[model samples]
Target: MQWIAALPMYNIAPALADDWRALLGAVLGRISPWLDARGDTVRIVDPGADLTAFWLRDDVLLSQTCGYPLLHALSGRVQLVATPAFDAPGCERGGYRSVLVAGAQAGASSLEACRGLRAVYNDEDSNSGMNLFRHAVAPLTSGGRFFSSATKSGGHLASLRAIAVERSADVAAIDCVTLAFVRAHRPELAAGIREIGVTASAPALPFIASKRVPKGLVDALAAALSDVIAQDEALAGRLRLRGVLRFTEADYACIDRYEREAIELGYPRLA
Candidate 1:
């Protein structure tokens, strides 16, 4: 069995390694031994080596992901295994939102008020920071007049910092998950920022696996995750993962509406 775990190539903290090991050991188990016990050989691939192409590949066994672009990229090749949607179950039902934050001095009360101001986003492919930001502001702006400029800060924390410390951008939209994680682990980072508005909610991040994987194995993995969350307090504290919610089968088609609407509004730059 060939299993690969994909993670973003950003400035994630070193402590994430311990979290990964714990998750793999607890949720995925020793893949080789687990598979060998059932007559298979397992190989773990850290495809962060080539994120863009790696995510687009069809043969990889599993990848961790969230929201539209990734789903749009890997729709037919994978299935949802588990996700953090429980925090906002309505998102899975198609009504999730993202919070928009601005610098302490911006005094922007509404999306329209921030027009012509600088902005920062987590990533081009990020749904909360990009797609939803597009969806929220595209309809309300004229061509290239919405913001004076925009920067890709790579991660939510970077975006927040850009707005709060560097004063490079007046506003940013951070995914609620990343925001919550930062608050729990690094509240100082959020010190001078305040939320002005929240975009319509969308689905949370998901753990995905190849469609070829057995249903029983997937269920086992989900059960193991629940066990890990229950048994390992330190891992839970480190990861800040509330709990594993069962996977719901959703496809890129669901988010295509947002993409199309955004495009129609003339914000065609997908990042």
Candidate 2:
């Protein structure tokens, strides 16, 4: 009955990570009572922990995972808890979109203008970074290639920096929530970065528990998340969480469809 929790997606800037982690801890703490015996000893997974591995661990009581992985990689291994509604741009009804950003110096006025340039992504498994990016450019590309070169930056913020600061890449797809957080907290990171385009929307990442957990405990986790804002609106605001909403497996099927469409269109990869 090992239990671990993590929220890696929204905690981008290091200055806010500790406070954000504490807030997450408190929200989970508030739900302790409802979890019955299962909540007695929940540990926060280290922020630096490898989330990809954490997604596969049997001890994962709660974690936030991208919609792409939830369907393709961790499909039968995890159970959905709830989807957090964000009070940020590009977020609606528990779904979010990605922004295509290019360096101001690059002088690319539009996504169409940035073709055949070096591009970076958080990871191939990322929905906002890769999947949605591919879908957005699929119809606009030729010969199944979009960029002259494609590289992996490993994280959203890093992808932003790669284009905005390092100038190593001409453009990259970034999660809207991550970009909003940076623009609000540290505008300098967004310096030289301009949003040239936006990707199609998809369900926000989901809160999940390993399938090893009992159904009763999973239900309790969902109940707690749904009532978190009501339990403590102030803390919820600090965390940028508007509310949690119910989501079904069917709600995430669109992610797989994005992949299929990309293949069918003959632009199966983002460069």
Candidate 3:
């Protein structure tokens, strides 16, 4: 079977999709020759909204996934390729945080003051969008409830739009990387979204693969990813790319800790 390479997370925004594709194409350019030498072929693909089907297929030569699913849903189904380091604010090394945003009502206010308001999130399985946000509000919940309601906006951009444009939700949590991208490419779109606070940090989404990719090629892929950013300064700047870092799955145990801590605090859900 032919293999696939996709960076689904940051690639979702239409404003930034071409930039992601450029970087993906550059990385693939460096690595595809190696694949051809080994009698293998790979192509770049857009996995669309729901990634469950894409991730389940063993042909996932390369992909990115959130820490929540890396621990909860994916479990042992996929293995790490490498972690991409970002040069955005609220990012350090290869870890990133989520920024809690709101409109005029909650502007520059404390989380406690924003109680009983509606909240939007990218997805329940999203570490930055939901897991970290849950941990941030867990201590403020009463009787296992915090927001008057919590709804899924499907993606980080949608969450921001709900809070800023439609005004259907009072607040939402978005990953630092996506926030940085929006601020750079769609600054006006983010003018109304105020950053009230930020959630804790964990490994930014990680590159992953199934058994379809060989160990040698995985190592080469990681090295190529790390080197490409340095060799192509323009791509690096556009992608806000720093470099790639090697991480064992153990490094992501903190995700489980955040979830456990929230549960212990009586906030079992992001409601």
Please tell me which predicted candidate would have the highest lDDT against the true structure.
3
TM per candidate comes to 0.80, 0.93, 0.95
lDDT of 2 by residue, 143-188 (tens): 8887899899998878878887888998888888888889987687
Ranking by TM-score: 3, 2, 1
Clashing pairs in 2: none
Error of 3 at 25 (Å): 1.9
In model 3, how many backbone clashes occur? 0
Which one wins by lDDT: 1 or 2? 2
- Over 71-169, each residue of candidate 3 has an lDDT whose tens digit, in order, gives 877888887889989999999989999998887655547677778888988888989989999999999988999888999988888888787778888
Candidate 2: which stretches are off by over 4 Å?
Answer: 34-40, 47-49
Residues forming the 10-long window of minimal summed lDDT in candidate 2: 32-41
Q: Give per-candidate clash totals.
A: 7, 0, 0
The 10-residue segment with the lowest total lDDT in model 3: 104-113
Model 3: runs farther than 4 Å from truth?
12-15
lDDT by residue for model 1 (1-271), tens = 5555554422245566556555665565624445667665444466754465776664444556756755666666676766643333223332346788888878787878998788888777778888888888878877735888888987888888888888888888877656665666567768878878888766566666667677776676566667777688787766655577764645434456777887887877522
lDDT for residue 241 in candidate 1, whole number 0-100: 57
Error of 1 at 34 (Å): 4.5
**lDDT values for all models:** 0.67, 0.82, 0.85
